[model samples]
Target: MAKIAFILLCHKDPDAIIKQAQSLTAVGDYMSIHFDARANPEHYQKIRDALKDNDHVTFAAKRIKCGWGEWSLVQATLNAVEAAVDAFPRATHFYMLSGDCMAIKSAEYAHELLDRRECDYIESFDYFDSDWIKTGWKEERLIYRHWFNERTQKRRFYWMFEAQKRLGITRDIPEDIEVMIGSQWWCLRRRTIEWILDFVKRRKDVMRFFRTTWIPDETFFQTIVRHLVPAHEIESRTLTFLMFSDYGMPVTFYNDHYDLLLSQDFLFARKISPDATELRRRLGVLYSSDGQRFQISNEGRSLYKFLTEKGRIGRRFASRFWEKESSLGRERELLIIVCKKWHVAKRLLERIRQMTNIPCIEYLFNEDSCPLPDLGGIQSTMGKRHRHRRALMRMLFDYYDTDRLIVCMDPANLDLLEDFGRDRSLTRILEIECHFSDEYLIGHAMRVGLAGDRTPPETIQRLLPTVRNDMTHESDRIRDANFENFLRVREVDPTDVSARAISEFLTVPQDKAHEILSHDHLYAD
Candidate 1:
């Protein structure tokens, strides 16, 4: 059997590392793991002991301190690849995966899929010209120097950073080198892996240049791979499915994503949490990677073609949006929550509770009678249009720097989350639309009052706990047979609060509210 080597870069989660390793490792195949140099020794030893008996398991001789979006991360990956190359000399293909990465298909099927491959699989794209990679995004990170700190801090640099930008003294990226980037995980032909190691040895200057460059791990290897002779030897797709939300965070794999992950055609799904056991069960049967034979059946060939063609671009865009904006601040206190309307928040809150029981996120209900306190009501904003709502939100964030995590709730409010995507200080804007269940949400709303009295909000507040309990435990019963009036806007905003609230929720210009609302009715048509 042709052996495959898996290079896994792991830090904390020991169980996750073992789970993923056991799944991918076959009798003939090998797993080379690189534990972050900073990982707890006790934790690291536990894993080492667990896999020590397995002759195919190898640990990287060189371990490095790895940080997110830093040079260290790439260094760790490179080390793992080199280790795998030495340990599994007979391995035919190399897969770069994280500890959190899991096989979405049977190991046998994955082996069969790669054994028939004619080209290397990796994602490569132009750094500057890619639709997602604009000048504003890369200039400071690429043009200026960024010191790599294991734990990066928000250093408040005033004029000096600006002065450096003006001076533009920098190690120039070679003009011939095309900067390409993609997900960190990839499957490579053994030749490709060797070529990368050789290329790095030859291009020490490129490595040195990337040292001070921001997060060179994302670029250094990517740039070198583009120069590989007969570029057709490479395919610009990583066979890993990482679904990112509009906020640019990976959408956690859940029951809802089963069909999307299955139909979309990818081999591995990445960054799964340790608790995603259900998702692992849903993926399918586990098989011994070593014993699997490379049979080219018609179904297998068709499946391979399907995986090759569909890279899930529509699910996740190339070059994440406002990535720089996401790493700021801690959302400790205060609460800014926005809902499309009252009932929508209730539905989303139910689902969020079901997924992660982190109680930090509070749902904002639309006050049908009066604008609910701190809850964003579309009716509270007078402007019926979108732009008006956007402008209103920016102004609100600027003027009212409330010490609260702003949990925004509507899909139209997605742009508003961009402002805070970089601001870690604010709470994540929990949008209901991104959860993949508008229709289910509508069902939840219908069930919200189905089991209890059909009384209006004024009466529902006292019985809210009972109603919610009924909704959760006795899901089959209808508390209220009538749900049409559940979303009624009882009082009109006599003031222009609706437009202001909508602008804040949507992140558009205040004046453009009229423009957005003008086409609101066309949504149905």
Candidate 2:
């Protein structure tokens, strides 16, 4: 029997936790709970009473008051893990669940899936682009600035700052290093959990940092795991929707419109509604969880049986002219040549055709015009009118099979490339030798190139000329200051010969380079 443990940190919602716990118990899995310190003793007792019949449940020794943006919740979770490990040493897996989390599938099926993958089921939690920080609607500026400054402070504040700075960050850190942002809720293998606990014990500085930061729970596990485990071992896809909000909008959980989450690929989902009557009715046909096996439920079984009985009728109805075989042949190395316009795509194709004879597939996003002229390939046009350029690019790459190699024409394409880089199977190879007339575009290109197979350090260095030149045109002084600060933080000397080479290569005049370089205002914080 596979042993799986569920760890939950609960605050006021004892009833919700109890229901989720009951569902787990019904599925025959062990569970551990940590009531927030703020929960009344009587309420805690009531919660314990609710789960008393389940011999597998255990309570934590430490309780914490959890608030949004505070690290107390994470503290409680860490404390719960120590407790769970002590109580259930034999368990093979530990899943960090929330009071609101619901099991869409059976525990046994989930176990079989994890056992097959041998994966540590956690999202790759790393820093996103610095752009996210500037664009982030969340009121995290004071917290982020304080955390960045806190790095030089006393050990406690330093760790707290590190935790805050790293959490939910997508980009704009040092380019060479890859950072991941993980969900607070995840399932980990026993060995992985043991490794995490041991690593944290040794890293006193990281622990001390956690002391001051709020919501260190999510950052702590993600950062520790990244340091210990290979990037390939971590799952970039999350099983839950913890990141998205639930505003009681008319969203469907199990319908055609809501297919993104319910699609067979995801392992877990977050914040499942307690009142999921509509979801229950709609999903009754697709999934059903027995105590052990999560198989097709009775409703789905009947539907499938009916369809099978209808055989030729169903086949005839399903047959369509547009439904060509979805198979892309034996998984060859696919190079996703991403292009915005037909002429640019043609140029990229010409380059690829000149260098290698391999079959190249092009993904273009122009709605009004079809760029390729009889290339004998599939073409898709995005319907939405607005600048869904980013979203369209994301969807195109998401559809890419991991067996293929992806190469984009532009570096700005790197924004989409990072998402694919997180996937272990996909290989991102960049044709760095090819240069565009617009060097400012190189930063975006380099980002795309980095997302693929590793490019030499010198290649990235060569591209810095384009990056610095583009930096000069920015009207925002604060953004320019931050960009310079990033350079200073990395300790790259502007006076270096290589820096001079980059300054000379820019389209801007030599005087402008000196002017921009000498401008004290650009370096001012």
Best by TM-score: 1
Query: How do the residues 16-82 of candidate 2 rate in per-residue lDDT, one tens digit apiece?
Result: 6676676675655678899877445777888989888887788887887654445666778778888
Model 2 scores worst on lDDT over the 10 consecutive residues at: 482-491
lDDT of each: 0.54, 0.49
lDDT of 1 by residue, 376-444 (tens): 233254332233333233323322222222343433343433444434343333222112134443344
Candidate 1 backbone overlaps, count: 39
Most accurate candidate by lDDT: 1
Q: Each model's TM-score?
A: 0.55, 0.45
RMSD of each: 17.0, 20.7
Q: Lowest-lDDT window of 10 residues in candidate 1?
A: 482-491
